[model samples]
Target: MKRTTIHISAALALLLGLAACTQDEAGFLPEGAEGTPIVFTATGLNPAATAAAGTRAPVDGNWEGVSLVGVLIGGTVKAYDVTPTTADNTSATLTSTDPHYWTNHDDITVTAWWPYTEGETTPPAVVVRADQSSPTDFEGSDFISAENQPVSYGNPTLRFTHRTARVTVVLTDYTEGMASVKLTGLSTENGNPAEIAPYDKGGDTYTALVAPQSVATGTAFITCAFTNGKVFVYKMKEATDWQAGEEYTYTVSLAAAKDPGYTVSEDGKTYEVYNAEGLKNIAELVNEEWKLGINITLTADIDLKGIDWTPIGKDNNKAYTGTFDGGGKTITGLTVTGSNKYAGLFGRIGSGGTVKNVVLEGVQITSDNSSGYASGVAGNSWGTIENCSVSGSVSGSFSVGGVVGYQFGGSITGCSSSASVKGTQRAGGVAGTTNSGATLTACYATGDVTVENDGTSYAWAGGIVGTNGGNSILACYAAGNVSGKGSGTIYVGGVVGENYATVTACYWSGLPDNDNGGATKVDGTNVTWQTAVAAMNAALSGKGWQYELKDGNSLPALKKEQ
Candidate 1:
């Protein structure tokens, strides 16, 4: 019986060995063999070459979930799914359940595609629906791995490239009364039935994935519709070969398109001619259908002292929720005199709003209402305000500030204010009140803050922020005198009148005259007037604050005059 058992075991081993050899003969080694595992990597190609010569260009986006088809030297093809292991899809591992494993002596050619279906001769043509998201497209590439490779375990690598081109259209110099822009005649170059869809990337940017084809001369056209019910058509004059792994960017300026050389189509259906002009000023923008998410770019510096200025969104019912790009232009000599609750260049700025690269100089904002908000920039802001500077005076009965009256949530970074602030309740050189979701960083204020109330009312006055409620103030300083004179409770601090949250690496200069007034938190360091200059320069320099001494006696001003 023992002899019979040995004979059966030997026969079973032989059968298994034959099965392994059968798999090896089919162009794949048996599993668990002493060989390296094949790895597949995929990366997107940049749209254009970098300006630096001989430098490696950057990839556009993260690519993943690519289907790889490996054809062996003997014409035996196998399919494997390769998924990205990292977020960027720079590297991926090939996964398969086939019994055949790659060997050192094997030579294979591989083709890769995204959104590929199993058992398909060619990848399906990418069908982009009208509602498809921006950047919707498919990519394919082919590569060949030569013979006589190393036989180390887990060492073979394969890379895949993109075989399609992408195009991006940006509309610049946008004037008022322009509603929407559309690009047409983007079909197959051969006049095939293939349809291509361009996706909107929001705010005058459109992107489309195009197959490698040659566009017909003078066939492509773009249309811009204005609010005045006029349409303009721009015919393409130049053409190029749309190659794979390439990106093309087209910037269309509305100001340039308004030239008489371009054909203007007045009829909505057919192409006709119509003369168009851009809106004149901000007052026209305010009178138009200005709403949230609108993009406003200042072309030139606006002087509001001479014009009859009306603040945009002057009430809580209507708040500015758009983008205001100052283009490094200054709005000087802006004066606001009214008893309105909200008074500023912009009355209220809601969430999702942004104001940047703006400077307000010699502005005077005053509010006579007992409980109101007043500022040089905005009365209330819950959005982003960056790289902005204000030098003016703001006076109000309640919340008053230089940049913003009330900052609820969002960020105020790389900003400064040298405006004198006076309020009956809360007054701050930069911001009156900051809530929990607000963050003030890398900012400074050099204006005096004063809070005066005759009755038993609370007066909060600070050089940077009047009332800080569970917010974050980092690497900020104030070099201004803070005074609060009231019969009731008064809080005055050189940096912050009251503190509830964290303040890190913050400093304050000048003495607080009120004995009862001091930085609520001991973390805020105070430096005297004599050593304040050097101390501030040293402290700010350590935190990467760009500053320089223009005059010997003056404090270190921000490099941008903050």
Candidate 2:
């Protein structure tokens, strides 16, 4: 690392008169301020001590036609040619035909790079050489204006550090017949200098500018060529955070490539080897393992028909605490016909869990237990669900919904459900019940909610939520027909059967069919189908909701759903 100082000052009152009279078309300082020059003093510990002698030498007289310094002001950068004033090349003055100067009060940033073009403002990509004989060298530094204090006469110093890291791969204890090896999986392109490193090859070792962040956990491919004309492929696992100006080395032994066998192509020109077992299916994942804090990406849409399905987190006490990224894939033909208490793909979602980018299509979930929960996604949720949708049928005895049976505490955003929900006690198109700490935003439901109960049992059905216990519901709407049939007190509403929560910017359309004997009411705005659509569009658009008009649909659906 090296440190430098840049001095910018205005002359005394005597020179102000001259500066005011020298204003130019390029927006230089006024005439009287002309003599006040911006000076740059280079001073710092050498960054590359082991490099060649002239590598860290200052670019003084040699920088005549090159951009030695760049001044960034108001989001625009202006390069300036440098003219050394001293013999040591420690101090230099900026020279420009248009008098390129900045005011002392103007906040600006300065960057210094070697071998830069005359008018180039953006950093150039450091070229990478695949051959071990040739290698490219690149470096850059930046200084912000606010970090340094401005003086009327003195210069404010700045520090510069190497913006790239080095990585080396060592082959240890290799077989005698191994002739060649190649590594892949490292990123080779990045525009942000601080986040990603440009690729550079140096034979067995690679040196490049890499982002100072944690490297994602994955397998790196290693292809080896043998002297006997046989080729073998191996995968080396790597996980670490690469630091700037730091060197990392990885050692791999050839004996680690244990496998069933390698497959040969019909052409006999290529040999393919399987690294590890492929991703497990939904049923296999539920029966064999539980993933916590790990990300599960579904590679393809799953069909769970005619399979003995056990809900995740049901057999084991451990709840789902990892992230399930469906990658816009749907799980269709899901049939849960058990008498379990919690019946869904996920029995319960614990805190810090996330389920996103998934859709449950044509699912048929039913719980025969007298007091149980069933839904298309999760039976009970205390985590986050985003950009998810459900379209199916869910039936249970107690709590049942299209998306979630019970939202204990968490957030549900950009989600919708069109699954018909039926329950003996509590049923809703979106959620059967939501706690006070739960938040629902940009969610909607269009499925009909029905509550079938005996004369003595209580029934509640709603378009969105059967019961809201002081939860926050924002930017949500429902158009489902809610119905309740029972002798006991039945509550039915267009939006919520029982409201004891905060509902904002929510609307409901289509009145409930049968309202039985209970103190039930629609909490949000109740309007006709057309008026509800218009009002919802206006309100949601004002709140920056991304929506699109579907063919033959009165209201716009969320862009994420589409």
Candidate 3:
């Protein structure tokens, strides 16, 4: 329960809402409405500034979490503060709550410098120097690095409040000498009406005292209000905090996050936070043995460096979320290798999030022994995936797929796969087996899929789905060579092996050969290619997927529900 700061903007929300409404309009044009920019100023600690001694002691008051409030910057103690300026719509400040140097009764002045820019292209580089004793000269300085390279300090990273129009002080380093960390600078912005509740963490207890509900009557977005009426807004990107307190009560304020760039890797088992530039790929900063939950956003291209997934045990359940804009750059040349039955990049994805503009390429697997399921990006998919692709080889004795081995609901849209897949029983190019209702739209598969004889009865296996218990396959196409043999019964198709549910607007040109088959093998009842195409084409009628058929569109349009 750390004291974290998050900001929201009224204008941004309105714009986004408008965009969403016009997304489906035939002639909708994207409005080039740019955002506003803001300037930041640093507040310092005065020499004669005095406070109640041992007032907000670390182990005294009801604490929430750990935070880095004060730091020794350029031989002086500096107080962290966020100031406002004009052009407040476009820019933001970057700060963190990671551990920093702080001491009580220390005379440190936080000075504001202009045009903080880095010279190095790599990250983890030493940027600015924050020293001790005084803010005038650099004594003991800490360099901020990006991509493991020394870079110049860039722009000031600050958060603006949109609702309350108030500047929130994210207490990074706190001491007992300051009596208590207090936040000031408020304006009028109507936010949700709520009350402060009490909670306890360690041995201390505290209440989250928000501004009185009667503060304003209009809609209030969180904003950082400066001395004047300068207002800027920001949004919180995470769920946890590291402030030093038992229970942190947020009163409609913003919180700083752990800077992903220029972070010290605590251990080899947990994930590493690289400087902004050092984030090469998803594999560079993560591990399989440790469970450290981290949220991040990348401003540059990230390299995965060909890493495989770690097994899912009690020790590893780390969840990662955030935005990674590749600047229209492609995320490729990566591999996720595994041998066990339940091994995958996201072994257990319990959270509902997005991983886009990514490629799971050249995935090679050997072992087929799995008690549950496995896939390239995830073992079990219960979320959504968009604008992604996979190219790999999978061979297992049980359930397997190019994208996911098992899916229990959720959606996969704007994605494709081109991997050679093999499995003992349930096998598919996109999904091996599905238990819950899921949708795969505008997704195509072009892999050689096969199912082996495991000396047991087999049921479902197809180019798109092994068995279609109750999943919908829309605007999807498959061109894979499928071959399988079953004792009790077997179902194989160009799109799906067995269809107990619906298969709409999908096309399958997978011809059964001398080794495989010509069409679907359903309990010895086979459907010819003409029949399959007719049924699939019939389902396309008015759906956007009509183009997936012979004389229709090439790709499917995104559905409202999906």
For model 2, residues 1-562, the per-residue Cα lDDT tens digits are 1222222223355467666665443255553565444555543323333133322221111222334555433444555566654554434455545433545435445555443455756544443333322222223321112112232324533333333445555555545565566544545454333222223334334333343446566544445566867676555465676554455666556553323223434753222222112222332343465544455666566666665456765533656777777778777776778797878877777889888887888888999988888888888888987888998899998889888888889978788998899998888788888885898778889888898877667778878788776367776777778888767888887777777777766666546743321222333345444454455556566554554545534654876422
Best by lDDT: 1
- Stretches of candidate 2 exceeding 4 Å from the true structure: 1-290, 455-457, 513-534, 537-544, 551-553
Report lDDT (CA) for all predictions. 0.64, 0.61, 0.45
Better of 1 and 3 by lDDT: 1
Model 1 is weakest, by summed lDDT over 10 consecutive residues, at 270-279
The alpha-carbon RMSD values of the candidates against the true structure, listed in the order shown, are 25.1, 28.4, 31.0
- Give lDDT tens digits, candidate 1, residues 442-509: 78888989999766688888888888763787766677788978688888888788777777666666
Clashes of each: 0, 14, 95
Tell me how far the alpha carbon of residue 477 in candidate 3 is from the true structure, in angstroms, after superposition.
1.2
Model 3, C-alpha of 297: deviation from truth (Å): 4.9
- Candidate with better TM-score, 2 vs 3: 2
| Model 3, span 173-277: residue lDDT tens | 211122222222222224322221122222222222222222222323233334333344433334333121112333333222222243333652223333323
Q: How do all models score by TM-score? A: 0.47, 0.47, 0.42
TM-score of 1: 0.47
